[model samples]
Target: MTDLASFPELLAGYFEIPIDEPGAKAVSDPYGSVRVDVGVIRQEVRSPGYLVSGLVYDVSTGLVESVVAPTQVPTG
Candidate 1:
């Protein structure tokens, strides 16, 4: 497995964004959630929107356990 510290660089490369351009935005899970740094790399869109994807790293374990993608929600 790759080092958790390198996730930001990996994400930057995957998204074709500059590593030094503040590409990765840090996020967090709900309260009582596991300790992890959630880095979101939003999908670039022409208009304003919320579509995004990211990686989850376990802070205690120093490992990346999963990649997350946006899920569709039914609209009324």
Candidate 2:
């Protein structure tokens, strides 16, 4: 397991699937309640946006996987 404290330069950012996108529909009573977070772990502030980069740890394999690569996301 890697310690998150090792990368002080990185900031935590949560990325979720857009509500309007497919597969974001609610499974229960409330419509559009089932939002999913892609789980972006760290990013770098780039003024107008953030440089998104993150990894997912698979407990089944006990390995780290890269889900979201370095990409720029607009804040607006």
Candidate 3:
């Protein structure tokens, strides 16, 4: 909730999720617990907005594979 803004790199990677098996999962990091899925993000993306932020996970084990944050984004 409050810490959702901590990881932007992993979230950005989801932007490249294959169009077929976009995954969904809950991750616990410095930002607390979050429910995320590239599929959902793809379905509901609002550009000109803040970059995404969260951790990625394995669809089967729910193990965090990586942390993602935009790190930096073009402001134009």
TM-score of each: 0.24, 0.33, 0.25
For candidate 2, lDDT tens digit of each residue in 1-76?
A: 1342233233122123343332232222121221123222222243465566555656688988665566675453
Over the stretch 1-76, how does candidate 3's per-residue lDDT look in tens digits?
Answer: 2243345455435545433322223333322333344435534665565565556556578787445454332343
Which 10-residue window of candidate 1 scores lowest in summed lDDT? 31-40
Sort the predicted structures by lDDT, highest score first. Answer: 3, 1, 2
Clashes (backbone N, CA, C under 3 Å), per candidate, total 0, 0, 8
**Model 2 bad stretches (over 4 Å):** 1-49
lDDT tens digits, residue span 13-75, model 1: 654667763223321232212222222222223334444444466778898754555533222
Q: lDDT at 69 for candidate 3? A: 56
Task: Decide which is better by lDDT, 2 or 3.
Answer: 3
RMSD of 2: 13.3
Tally clashes: model 3: 8
Q: What local lDDT score does residue 65 receive in model 1, on the 0 to 100 scale?
A: 55
TM-score of 2: 0.33
Score residue 49 of candidate 1 by CA lDDT.
46
Question: Which of 1 and 2 is ahead in lDDT?
Answer: 1
